[model samples]
Target chain A: MVHAEASTFAEGLSKKQVYEQVLGQAQALFDGQRNWVCNLANASSLLYHAYHSLPSPSNAVNWAGFYVLDPKNPKQLILGPFHGQVACQTIAIGRGVCGTAVEKKTTQLVEDVERFPGHIACDGASKSEVVVPIFQDGRVVAIIDVDCAELSGFTVEDQVALEHVAELIAKSCDF
Target chain B: MVHAEASTFAEGLSKKQVYEQVLGQAQALFDGQRNWVCNLANASSLLYHAYHSLPSPSNAVNWAGFYVLDPKNPKQLILGPFHGQVACQTIAIGRGVCGTAVEKKTTQLVEDVERFPGHIACDGASKSEVVVPIFQDGRVVAIIDVDCAELSGFTVEDQVALEHVAELIAKSCDF
Candidate 1:
């Protein structure tokens, strides 16, 4: 799975440049790929590479990553490739909004950090957050996420983007 | 499933503005509720209201949607709910780049229409396109789609928006 695909992603790209690259690549890949999971993985890897190392590039998000569903266990979405200081490899289906998304079978966009039940503090600094569900057979299977150090960092533009992507998943995912 | 949830939304918002309102509602519901399927379903309904009968709005995308994975079938992205039409219900995973995205598990930025294989002509005039994947368990389960009637209709900003939602699905999915 570790291919030399992202090599041209600019080892020399600055943090700001990296973020711009991530953003650019995000648009490019999405327009080019039109597939949600692949784009999700790509976006997660790009952001992870930029942010996972903390004191990361200026543009990298503080904490960002994805937890995918196991084909063997559709009940939970295990943390897959991401960008941030570290990763949360395990999350149950009904535990938090992220997990509850599966149980609830819907996208959960949390604007306030303090109110969520079972919220994991992987990054205590993350204030506002958003989670969109990936569905199959009218069922919740996985979730996509973005966390920011700033409270209410998630925006209208951001919601539209995420929701649009979620919309795509709902349509094309026949797996 | 068809509750009068967005009746208010329908009253105040223009057809084009409906997408934005739905996105806003979707974001709030994400943070506040656990009805994952309902959340997405509602979002789809808003989009359907916004552009379904309109003449593909000007200055913005006319319609947008996604596909989901079906446990029983891995070869196609079963169209779930969308903002435009219902005919795009079943698209083979390998027929078009959208399908190939499932095949490659990679994002595709297509600037031209005739280039992709099995490209379902949701909007035959659509020139440029973007496909982002929704993943669960390191495997692609769906795709996010944004189509414009104009060729090369997408930009970096659009990509950012689409990917954000895509990530939301990846993170908020039941997984």
Candidate 2:
């Protein structure tokens, strides 16, 4: 495995590297990695898959995943994999980051984390965040999420990267 | 366009019927036919889509969209879809129907609702449910849910139907 400086991942990060890293991590974990559940839980599978497939590293801030617990209930959004600090659990359908994400049914790549309201502090240090809803049979079952320490963690490239992740999620669900 | 009694759907209800019904309903709300999202939210989507395409449904389930929500956060997965009647929005990573589903990372189709423990009561009326996870890339991002107001709302056909839906979701995601 290749070790990259956080700084190297910070500036001019290529999407390929991001995706490769995530794939590598997933492959390693899948190759009997320890406490697989620790990383696999909370949409980490989607996160690892999406993160590695991205084409631009600069867009890492926007990488994330959101899932649902009960779509018929409209009460919560499931937490998935992320690139930055974030809550590791459910979000109400009409409440904070998860709630707003559900309410809008659209992906939000927050540029400034401080300005956002009701931001869950899984990693209190995290600033920017991105969220995307997971739709089931026309209804949103969950969402894709991402968090970043940088204010401008998300960008068009990040959005594009997630779109690919979303597509990957959309395709690989054959259980 | 077609409103068949839920019971009628039980008797060889063609997957095409499910797809048509799902898309028809989605079109009523959204602007277009993004079959992948609308279909995969529930395992029925796969069954229905396959029915539409192959005129035959496969036996599969999609699980990934939903998660057990953190009560303190009250945002994400509290339980899995196709669950029994209980307050399941706050299930742990490996408890109850939701947790069991995540632990296995596969669809759990209960034949009898009364037999299952940790059943949530979003609708006590439902006797049977099918929960399928939706995947983006290789990770679970959402789940396809199917519930029968009666016992055994799902079948092998239903399983295939929902898996088709999961495929659509996987295709639509950003990964």
Candidate 3:
């Protein structure tokens, strides 16, 4: 939870302003918290709340969470902490957007899940998605996945800010 | 997640209409899902999305989720599926608002958390809260907890509709 004392984005704030506040809250919420689960839990919560407070297009966010690489199967991803509906439990490294992010070691910002070939429909309400791979020791460790209810719900600003959050989580947690 | 094909609330609908729609969605979302975890996951998602579409005061909601009775410790309530920040992991029965609801076996609708004595500060940002006990076999199995960012955020109508939701969840899930 973002501390009650943490700064809040004023109504009608720009995306950059919101992400900036989110980054501050993310650092404050995650710093020194070494448990990956706790870190992801709070980080996802911070993003979910921050964007939900923003304008119409941004506030349509329906899902925000993570998918961590399975230790038993390095090439597969398993469900992690999340803030929305029951999700698909597992995805192969190259099967879905999350897996594709892990396989490519890059961010996947899908403007429309329906248009993205081989898209995995975990929550049927999600229309767009952004998945950012978290890295540790020069390899992908997990991916931060955010889904919005509107098509093209995410933008470049969200991608950049979330990538920063993923980096922070990768470094702070003892994954 | 509410299925993309699920009927949606039309623009500018009345509060009563919205809740009725929400109730219908809740039933449809939970109908065939028997797993307790999966049921709570989708139930909360349904509420979160249903309210997020409402107007200002109604849209002030920040947290929606559950606290189930821990089998090993019937005197405590353990956090279950939730949307919002990381929450308080446990609340002793007869203690906090959640506990008070369990002890009293009634719905709790607090207009302001600040005025509620011994209110547990799970999320400092939460100003108002509502908790409804889910009963099974004549005992409380869980409580549906909703928190809002605005003081006096919940209403009698909300209490009624959410209580209905709790009843549905209690009946549908295999606790």
Task: Kindly list the per-residue Cα lDDT of model 3 for residues B28-143, writing each as its tens digit.
Answer: 76665555655566566667766677887668888887888876578887666666665655689998799999999999999989888889887788899999999999999999
Docking class of 1: incorrect
1 or 2, greater by TM-score: 1
Off by over 4 Å in 1: A1-175, B1-25, B32-36, B45-60
| Runs in model 3 lying further than 4 Å from the true structure | A5-41, A51-62, A66-95, A99-115, A120-128, A132-143, A148-175, B1-8, B12-16, B35-37, B52-57, B69-78, B83-92, B121-127, B136-139, B149-156
- Compared with the true structure, what per-residue lDDT tens digits does model 3 show for residues A44-122? 6667777788887789997788888866578788666677655664689998788889988999999999988789887
lDDT by residue for model 1 (A15-128), tens: 445445555555554553444444554455555444433342223345454566755566656654333333344567887667776777666667767789888775566676
Candidate 2 lDDT by residue in tens digits, B89-150: 24454554555665577877876667888765444554676776666656555555445555
TM-score for each candidate, following the candidate numbering: 0.41, 0.37, 0.66
Candidates sorted on DockQ, descending: 3, 1, 2
Model 3 docking grade? incorrect
**Lowest summed lDDT window (length 10), candidate 3 chain B:** B1-10
Error of 1 at A67 (Å): 29
When sorted by lDDT, best at the front, the candidate numbers are 3, 1, 2
DockQ measured for candidate 2: 0.02
* Each model's lDDT: 0.55, 0.46, 0.78
